[model samples]
Target: MRHQKHIIAVFGGREADQKLLEEAEHFGQLAAEAGWIIICGGKGGIMEAVCRGVDAKGGISVGLLPEAKDIEANEYVGIPLATGLGYARNEVLALACHAACAFGGKYGTLSEIAHALNNQKPVAAVESWKIQGVHECNHAWEAFEWIQTQLK
Candidate 1:
């Protein structure tokens, strides 16, 4: 039997700072190198950064957009899924992936984390939230490592 590629959802702020964006980009690159597909919110900031990294490494990126318009997705998104569910799309994002990772974010990111946990998906956080049951890491690489273990 052929093994399926793992899908990892990366959640973060749409208006994240440059440092956070860089970290997210590196996280996406590492995930791609590990042969995992990246899923994200499909907008700007961390989403765009991660998608760009995935594109740079020739990895596929799936974008879950809250809007119905395909133009809402970032340029690097290889696959744009327009849900038109707004914040409710978080449920789809959580359920669609094998695991999830959260960078520094706002309410939207928090919602994604909650949805993932509620769906029984393992989640790793990098300088993000401090909720119980969520693996916390100091860096994106650490978070990816934890996610890799969880996928096993």
Candidate 2:
């Protein structure tokens, strides 16, 4: 049995940024424990951290990927949906979520955040490189709690 309520897409850096990865994983775990489906880019860094956290907690996760490239999906990803549309497919992934959380990131994360906001999905930023939507704590736990409260 799966509890799929408002899938929360987490967007952040691909690089091995410690802060971003920690925050992403924390947020992903929190969301999963709270019974929300976790959605992500399905790659590395923030995405990998989040997926790992979700899996560790025995929660569900979805990887809305650009395409199934030579590389494989992250270990934590339960469902990998290859759009085959490249980065542009990010819009579809971001829009699919009822809400989105953005941590430290560059261009790709920024794009997902933009799409989520454009689609009216409540977007939250946790110590992001560029702040947008709701600004909250630097920690993912705090950010997730705030987002949950906002949705309620």
Per-model TM-score, in order, reads: 0.96, 0.89
lDDT of candidate 2 at residue 71, scale 0 to 100: 56
Worst 10 residues of 1 by lDDT: 12-21
Q: What does candidate 1's lDDT look like per residue over 6-113, in tens digits?
A: 999999888888888888999989988899999998999889999998998989999999998878799999899998889998889899999999999989999999
Give Cα-based local distance difference scores for all models: 0.91, 0.80
Task: Name every residue pair that clashes in candidate 2.
Answer: none
Clashing pairs in 1: none
Model 2 collision count: 0
List candidate 2 segments past 4 Å from native.
1-4, 68-71
> Which ten residues in a row are the worst by lDDT in model 2?
129-138
